[model samples]
Target: MGSRNSDRIPIQMRRRKCETVADMAAQGWDVLSKCQACGLVMRVNLKMIAKVSGPATSLWNRKQRCRRVGCTGFIEFQGRAPDMHWHETLAAPSDGEM
Candidate 1:
């Protein structure tokens, strides 16, 4: 009798308040976004931050797809600035490390 399955969908618990990317960086909080359709999690990075800083873009309005194969689900980010200005650091490989 149901036209769509409810159990297959994911429940997204996004941040209730929106904050700027700079604020998040200042507070030591990484932009955490979860897929609303499949519960997949994606962290905001420098690239993502730069991508949304164009003339018309928003971090919260960005949509991404679930990484799992065969999962016909899409995720959107909300409750914050659509861009950021931070980058994560990684340890450099020593001597002959590729």
Candidate 2:
């Protein structure tokens, strides 16, 4: 009935949820939008969004249309952390370029 990792707190409880645009901005997160039809991926303009809409705007479950020429598509959004691509000094040469 004894376990070494039993006392450790769960990762879910330790992690903070970034719900709103303000929360994402405060935590250094970028909102990435991918086009459904054209398959183009681009970072969303959070500052412009916040100004036009509100800082409390939620990215999920929103029906956003893509503004690309000659393409009728929707945008799928996702959040990305700043350090996701790996920090400069920590990457190994064996890993190669991404």
Candidate 3:
């Protein structure tokens, strides 16, 4: 039984890999937005970009609210930046953790 389960593990892993590849293919370039006030950038992964936009927008809105008495117009859109490969490297799961 243990050997049988072990054999199934590779099959399961292959399925997961195929699913991830399909998801990656379905998602093209991601659209990102930035807040001018705090220079906070929100990266929207295209797979579920629309679903996540509200939270990202809310974060920017909350950041715009000034606790200080003299501040006004705290939030503005700064625009997008080119996606960086370093981010992918950082996001990859470490072998040790796996």
RMSD of each: 18.2, 12.6, 14.7
User: What lDDT is reached at residue 32 by model 2?
Assistant: 76
**Candidate 1 structure quality by residue, lDDT tens digits, 16-35:** 22223544444444555566
Worst 10 residues of 2 by lDDT: 86-95
The TM-score between candidate 3 and the true structure equals 0.25
Candidate 3 positional error at 14, Å: 36
Predictions in order: lDDT: 0.44, 0.59, 0.32
Q: Per the 3 Å backbone cut-off, how many clashing residue pairs does candidate 3 have?
A: 0
Top TM-score prediction, candidate number: 2
Clashing residue pairs, backbone N/CA/C < 3 A, model 2: none
Runs off by more than 4 Å, candidate 2: 1-16, 83-98
Sorted by lDDT (best first), the order is 2, 1, 3
Best-matching candidate per lDDT: 2
